[model samples]
Target chain A: MVVVSLNNVTKKIGSKTIIDNLSFDVHAGEVFGFLGPNGAGKTTTIRMLVGLMKITSGDIFIDGHSVKANFEEAISKVGAIVENPEMYKFMSGYDNLKHYARMVKGVTLERIDEVAELVGLQNRMKEKVKTYSLGMRQRLGIAQALLHRPKVLILDEPTNGLDPAGIREIRDYLKRLAREEDMAVIVSSHLLSEMEMMCDRIGIIQNGRMIDVQLVNDMVNGGNVSYVISAKPIDQAFNVLQHAFEGINVKMTKQHLHVEGESVDVPKLVKRLVENQCDIYEVKQVNQSLEEKFLEITSEKGGIA
Target chain B: MGLLANEWIKIFKRKSSYIMIGILAIIVLVAAIGMTFINNQGTETGDNGNWKTALEAENKDLKEELKSTPGPYKKEVERVIAENEYRITHEMPRVTSYNVWTFMNGMMGLVDIVALFTIIIAAGIVASEFSWGTIKLLLIRPINRAKILLSKYITVLLYALFMLAILFVLSFILGAAFFGFEQNQPHLAYLDGQIVERAQIPFLLSQYALSSVGLLIFTTMAFMISAAFRNSSLAIGLSIFLLLVGSIVTSIIAGFFDWAKYLLFANTNLLPYFGTGTPMVEGMTLAFSLIVLLVYFIIFLVVAFWAFVKRDVAA
Candidate 1:
């Protein structure tokens, strides 16, 4: 089932359109990544889905319940962490969970403990949130969002402030949650590589519009192939590769030439480079990283990523 | 119901709330101790003073009447003796646990501490969400916005109740310890309109209790003010300012207009069961105060709910 659906959702703040007729679906058990740059309407869309903000136009549905008409019922099925995870900092982590647990239905004390364990905060659950590190706070946020056993989890930039290790832990944990727990997760991030690693499908949003919705494999074109040609006198190396490989694009960085072409084109280029007395030190095909893809999409609309 | 329980937990969980309770306790203790010392210091030390001379003259007149009585003057003599004994021992007019409470209640105006505390505590009852950046978290909880607001208002009332209960207990304990619970034998005869002898002490206590209900209404009005204004400083500041200025405004307005009775704070203490034992005016009844408060309470609650649910959590 589609756990969440936005049909042409549009929202405007004053004269600026923050979310422009965006549409997407989060299926059950799928880790969906909402990829966008800053001000690309990722938070706005999530806020609308969670009923924090009204939709200027269009409709949002959570498990087939209209967010506008049946907001309470719709929002009950959703647990979200928007922007930053804010909680009662004076309360212990366990107490914070307990406090939020009461707001949700059928959330038992046992479930609270379970969620704490799931977020890897079981050891420090009794400690005050003020004493928690930023990573622990992020985990606690996830735990709070997951406390009610929500069918859909919407987190915006859940891993933004974390160190690399913290990021990996959250990524692995969320992936496990989606696969094992059968939750449809909508994770928003500016870092496309993280999303690519964790998300099964991604919705690329830019300037308030959902530019594209595709599987991770399709977004990368099964990780689009690129060739890096390194030959002495790099200016000549670029001319040699471009002439030999027609219809292929080339961009020159300081020490090497980056060429986007077929994987098979590398050997042909290497042979030509040696023949032209261009000292060929490296001829390698590089896979386009998710960061590169994200930049390509968001940069067109002037997004700051 | 679970949500309401959650709201209650929030009140107990925050450290600031406990601080508020502690402040209330301190205020009550200080007031009780200070009043006791002042009262003791002001009493006449010597027996044969000016007050005694006047009393002796009155006693002589009453004795003359006893001599005129041909039948049993024994009862009259006993009554006069009791009166003189009471006069000599410092009957301590208006001094019971309930009377101290009334006196302390009046002194609420003199000291702005309780009013300050009420504003500080009650103002954040609703508006704290904005300051703490918790509005979005609270709104996404799936409960109705009306319930959210009602829950907050209920929490503030609970705080008020808890504070008042603490003050009541502390005052009584301190008052009894210092003043030595003197049976509170009613001495003021014909209080307001009713006839009274030395046997209506329990009745007086009950009347004071009824009168304190008026004070509770005043607290609720402050709660509504806090809820209406979402900023703690503004909420607390405005409510206290209005409270301090309200009586002055009432008297000033009354100087020009008569409809000032409808103003909420004017007749908040509806049962002035203190001085003269009756309401200043015939119409300033407890029921009238309650009705006006209910109207204001409903309006304030409606506005709080509407603002909470509809206002964007932009922060």
Candidate 2:
């Protein structure tokens, strides 16, 4: 089920368009990653969804309520952490959560304790927020956001200042939340590797426009895959394959000949190479990582990587 | 209602709030101790009967001095003679009594301290949320923006009333300890070209309530600044500067411009209309000042709520 939807959302501040006619949907029990370079309107879109900003033209619906008209109803289903997870420095972590819990209904003491343990902050809940580390504060922020059992959770740069272990911890918790709680999670970040590991699907945005939205595996290895051919007499094998697979792009790098095609064509190409007096040693498929794919897509759209 | 409670809890949790309360308590204690010392000195020196005789002597001296004094000094000497005669006929006690009326009357000075602390809290309440980036957390919740702002404003007024109550109870306790309890005392006021006497308790309570008119206006001004500007230091600095020098500046301008009567500072003090003193400008009546205050009060609230609701939380 689609828990969050943005329909032709556009935001203009004075004459400059910040987010232009953007549209997307996030389904329940899935992790959706929003990817963009600097100034790509990722934060702006998140702000509109959370009702911190007003949409200039279109509407954002969360759990069947419009953000522009039914703000309180729409926002009740969303729990977000925009930018850094800032909180009252003078208050204890537990007090901060309790303070926020009062603003929403049905958030009892047991719920607070449950979230605290979920975020691994049960031990440090009594300490003042000023004394907490950045990672600890981030955990506490997530705990506060989860108190009311929101249908959708949004986080912008959740791993911005965390070490590797902290990043892994957040990534693990987000995945668990989506699978166990059946919640839709929308996260925006510039860290491609982390997003690659954490997200099931990603939407690329640039210059207030959404470039594409696709599944993570499809985006990385869905289309034409490249295969490296290691055979004897490398130059001869490269020429034979190029001639046999006419109009198909092929290249030779050092000791191997690279061919681009579907997995089904691998046996046919091998048969042809064998018939051309070339001995096939090994054939390996080259799978592109999300980082390379992201660079390729963004650069194709005239954006600096 | 829940929002207001949230704000109230947030305020008391901060150390600075407690510091402000501590400073107020220390100031009141020191003043009470000083008054006690002065009262003890007066009693130790055996000056119990000197007040009446001294007033008589001063009355004779002032009457003689009025004959040869210059035009400017004559008005001052005649006023002194009138005050001395009133004290003699009314049998008013000296300052050394430290009675309930005296203690309550002395509390007028502490009102300014209350205003100062209240202004500090009011100025920082909204601005600090933005400065600390906690405003995003607040706005993302299920509450409306107007309710959030209203809760914060109400919290400030509640805090001010709490401080005022503390001052009243503390002064009453100290007054009873120093001068024992008196059944009936008259509070004297100069009103309508005559000296009118009123019940001490009601008169003192009115004085305290009237003084708070200025306190409320200044607190509203501070809150307006806080909501309009996201910078806490700027809000606190500008509002405090105005609170300290606003009246003096308005008085100086009133000399050159009669239109100054419409300024906020010129109308905030309602005590003059209650018989404690005279209005700052001639023809400035109680109803007129109240109307002026009501207008400014509405404007401040309108501007504050409008700005807070319309502003996009971009940061």
Candidate 3:
């Protein structure tokens, strides 16, 4: 089920368009990653989703309520940590939770403790937030966002300032929250590898626009297989493949000529290469990782990042 | 109500709030004890036995000085003479001894200190959230921005009242402990060109309330600045600077301009209408000052809420 959606949302400041015609949907029980480089409107989109910034046009709906028309009702179903999850540092972690607990309805002291334990912050909740490490602060922020049992949880740069182990811990917690609680989680980050591990699907944003959205598995393991041909006298093989695969990506890297095409055509191409008196010593296929694909997509769209 | 409680708890949780209260208590104690020491040393001079004769002699010297006194000091001399003549005719004895009531009366100057600290709170209430980067978390709550801003404003007013209450109750207790009580006394004053008598406590409280007009306006201005600027230092610095120098500047301008009567500081203090003093400008009445204050008050609140609710929470 679609739990949250942005419908053609655009944000403008004076003559500058910060976000231009962005649209996406986040489903229940799934982690949707918002992947983008810095200054690519990742923060702006999150801010608009959480109602911290107004959308210049279009609207967002959360759980069947329009964020623009019925903000309180729409936002009530969403728990969000915009930007750094900047909480009151002077207050104790428990007091901070209590402070946010007072703002929403039906959040009990029991709920507070449960969330703290879930975030593994139960032991440190009595200490002042200023005394918390960055990872501890991130956990406290997540604990706060989960207090209301929101149907959708939004986190902007949730892994920021975390150590590798801390990042893995948050990643596991987010996945469990999506799986066990059946919550829709939208996480925005520029950490490509982190998103690949944590998210089932990701929508890549660039230059205030959506470049592409795809499932992580499909993006990495699907579509054209890239064959790297290491042949003797490679110049002849390069010329033949270059002329044969007219519209395909055929490029030479070091000793191998990389030709991206359908797997069924590989044997035919090899025979043709053999006909040209080219010796194919080895033919290996490379499954592009999400990071490589991300680079290709972003660079193909524009060299903005 | 929950928001108010949050804001209140936030204020009181900090050590600075307690420090403010502590310093205020210390000031009252030292002032009271010092005044007691001075009162004991001069017992013979205020013996009420020859008080009328002493006042008559002083009045003769004052009348002689009034003729040669400059224009600015002339009104003060005239007021003293009028007060002394009224005291003799009415047979009201001079305040020859300190009483708890009088001690409390003198301690009213500490109200300004309350205003100063209250201004700090008002300035930081909204702006500090931005500086700390907590506004993002705050504004994302299911509550509307207007309600949140209004709650904050109400919290500021409530804090100011809380501080004032502490000052009043603490000063009252300290005053009683320092100076033993006499009977509830009446305050002597010059009213409408004649010396008149007023109830002591009611009059003193009214004076305190009236003096707080400056406090209330400046606090509101500081809140507006905080909402608009998102910087506590700017809010605190600009508002406190104006609070200190605004009246002096207005009086200086009042010497040369009639329009000075419309200025905020010119009318913030409503005390001039009650006793021996005159209005800063001719033809300005209590109603005029009230209307000016109300206009400025509404303007400040409207700006504060407008800026608070409409602006995006980027921080």
Q: Write the per-residue lDDT of candidate 3 for residues B1-315, one digit (tens) a residue.
A: 888888889888899889988888889889889988998887776566777898899999999998898665666688888888888887876787887878887888888898999899999999998998988888888999888888888988888888878877777787778777666568777776777778876777788887788889889999999999999999999999998999999999998999999999999888777774667877788999999999999999899888988888876
The best candidate by TM-score is: 2
* Backbone clash numbers for all candidates listed: 0, 0, 0
Candidate 2 stretches greater than 4 Å from native: A262-264, A274-282, B42-96, B179-184
Residues A1-305, candidate 1: write the lDDT tens digits: 88899899989889888888888888999999988777777888888888888889999988889999999899888888888888788789998888888787799999988888888899999899999999999999999999888889988898988999999998998888888989999999877778888899998888788877889988776645877777898888888877886668888999989887544466677888888889988878677777777777667656544
List the DockQ of the predictions in order: 0.50, 0.83, 0.79
TM-score of chain B of each: 0.70, 0.87, 0.93
- In model 3, what is the error at residue A193, expressed in angstroms? 1.5
Off by over 4 Å in 3: A228-259, A264-284, B60-78
Q: Write the per-residue lDDT of candidate 3 for residues A1-305, one digit (tens) a residue.
A: 99999999999999899999999999999999999999999999998998888999999999999989999999999888887868888899999999999999899999999999999999999999999999999999999899999999999999998999999999999999999999999999998899999999999999999999999989878877787889978888889888875456788877999888655378878998999999989998788788888898999998857
Model 3 lDDT, residue A285, Cα = 79
Model 1, DockQ value? 0.50
DockQ of 2: 0.83
Kindly list the per-residue Cα lDDT of model 1 for residues B33-96, writing each as its tens digit. 7777777776754443366666667778777778676443344454554556456566433232
lDDT of 2: 0.87
Better of 2 and 3 by DockQ: 2
